[model samples]
Target: MDEQQLSAAQLAEAGLDDWRQILGRLKARFRTGDPATGFALANAIGQAAAAANHYPDLTLTGADVVVTVSSPDGPGITRRDADLAGEISRLAARLGATPDAGGLTQLELGLDTAAGTRLGPYYAALLGGEVTDGEPVDRSGQVPTVWWQDPSEDNDGPALPAQPFEQRWHFDVWVGHDEGERRLSAVLNAGGRLVSDAAAPAYWVVEDADGNRSCICTPTGR
Candidate 1:
């Protein structure tokens, strides 16, 4: 099977249970400013589940907690991983949490969406990001991920998260120097700030509008 196609045991390792509890703890601990970001994140979770056609276990937190990407369904960053991370990125956008690129604290970037619609307006509305102005859009991921249904058309799943931030591992996004600048520009425009920068040819640390940090570098730099 592909990297995302995992056996039942692999799915089990992703923590199907207590998803809300984890999210809640994260929210309580981090106290991200925007509370609605949690719901936006919830909607994003539903969106990803819809797209992947697979549901991730979540801990209930009265509409304040949900599962994140990072929980791998397979070994290595497979197609599924990219897809999942993309979903989270798109969803986090809605909550004002874009990719940090540098100083990453969590890396949830693998999911496999065997089914679901790639062009979903609801997801766009939730994310507040337009669909690239018609570029023959496929799935909206720089990576491969899955969703159970499209958030725009989805009316099912764990509902929205009650708050922002969650328990998970951080991830770093690698890119070329030019791409790094572009990403940083977008992040800056989105309300993300530059957290750190390396002396290398192409390396930077950025925080999303929500304050999550991640690294950015060229592909070769990776």
Candidate 2:
């Protein structure tokens, strides 16, 4: 049987307070305070996942462990993911680890192009990923997803005239709602200028001194 996909509201109602939906996956970080504790937490999560027949990707560091849960059958969150996330949270608490939801972030690449159907396959081949709905998704989750956007289409920001030899690629940094302002401030302080904020609380477009653009995005108002 296919797994039932869960929406952001459903996840919140399910009591997965520690996890946040990033892109299409549920991500959370646990501060273990030390390498030993972090390893212990990772191991515990592994065992629990095995027992439950659902696994999550774990990144262990000297002071923390980042966990990402995604349904293997598809790209969205499901009940299995929520159950595994709850179990992981319980394990973290038992191991004296603290959940850091504010620190969770996801990065994605966007290319402005009117020919999404044509460019999607090229990007997918270049990134060794697969094309889905005019976006290239990295199956390994190591590389950021590359999405094609049509400049002529009505989007969040004002549409610009398609020009040749202009920069059309940008980065989308997805952060938690509470972390949006702080991150945007950091970018601005680093000499980045605001390009647009019409999508405030949803996203803010900013460009560096060299005109390289990126977006500070939040789940709010999305």
Candidate 3:
């Protein structure tokens, strides 16, 4: 990692209690209680970002404001992100806003394929994003990232033959480690079945009754 790039541990040590590192971005939600307050905070955040020459993606809902910050020129969190997180927290505090850490989550799309390199460009173009390190990433954060799982790369063996009826795509829903089990339980209660838990604390594969699958993921193992 570069000296400027911050790891998860460094981000925690920075005393940013209101923020969480999700999907390589520093994300946080502030409860504004009403649309008026949400807009005010959004405007304040915009001004702060403009002054620092670093912008964060801001979403203002009817009762909350979601802020996601990342280094524009890099792929991971950096010192500037931590600084801005602190400033945003302070601003929210002054406005009597409360941080809702539990509301943060990130969704990513995963494709199981033998020809990742060949199919990457097609998905990237369709999603209006670019392929970075074998994954399609939407810089605007408007769409979930698309990653590939190439079975052939597992043990230097030949690529496995594609099955006509196999499920080729799935979703990887990332949440805080502490929130993993609750999410899994919710899925089960909603008619989803546990497909696998061999990777507990990191991820668990769950499938809907019809067989569509999604993995509830956390940062614990990877």
Candidate 4:
């Protein structure tokens, strides 16, 4: 029914094995191939996990690694997930991951008169990223956060964006507390229409001008 509603086994049957593996861990997916980056990401993962005293479900997919969090098993904000995201954001900054306009998942990637707008900031917030030049950003867990957008990027950078998307960059976003209300108000204040009947009062479905759907939730056991 929901992301956490599924049994680990059912999640796997749905080809969502990664989520199941992470179990209580919120997942983070990344793509890269430089040996240096791979090692860096692995190290970051370990450092964060060990530092947080929480382990994550990490899967290596070709040139990428998918990390799912297993903490904060509650409904909305899990302490572990939040802490881990902060750690990842820090790692991204240290590595110099700048926000880009390349390919991203249909979910995270959206067109907003702002180039690298929603994603860079939204993710930076979602992941607890640091500020850079007034914009928030983080590398994709690959070390030495370089654009690595075009093929001409540094050998130790990302391959621009992973093409041929079957399972592209994907992550779970949790709207917590007053921040959700503030965002909803801003969206509405900016003329963003609420998608009623999508889930009714309990869970609201709102879309941006481009028709991308983001939910407004009350994380109170639902």
Runs off by more than 4 Å, candidate 3:
1-3, 155-165
lDDT against true structure, model 2:
0.84
Candidate 2's residue-wise lDDT over 25-61, tens digit each? 8899999999999999989999998998888898899
Could you tell me how far off, in angstroms, the CA of residue 145 lies in candidate 2 after the best superposition?
Answer: 0.8
Winning model by TM-score? 3
**lDDT score of residue 22 within candidate 1:** 17
Candidate 3 per-residue lDDT over residues 114-144, each given as its tens digit: 8888998898899999999877778787888
Which of the predicted structures, 1 or 2, would earn the higher lDDT when compared with the native? 2
* lDDT preference between candidates 2 and 3, better one: 2
Off by over 4 Å in 4: 1-25, 33-35, 72-76, 96-222
lDDT of 1 by residue, 1-222 (tens): 345443434533644221111111111111124556666566667777878865443333433443434333322333354455445545555566433223212222311232223543444445444444321222333332212322345443223323256422234554423356776787789888776665333456666666555555542232
Note the clash tally of each candidate. 61, 0, 0, 11
Model 2 alpha-carbon drift over 4 Å, by segment: 1-8, 73-76, 156-165
Local distance difference test scores for all models: 0.42, 0.84, 0.83, 0.45
lDDT of 4 at 82: 52
Evaluate candidate 1 by giving its C-alpha RMSD to the native, one decimal. Answer: 20.9
How do the predictions measure up, each by TM-score? 0.28, 0.84, 0.86, 0.34
Model 1: how far residue 185 lies from native, Å: 26
Question: For candidate 4, what is the TM-score?
Answer: 0.34
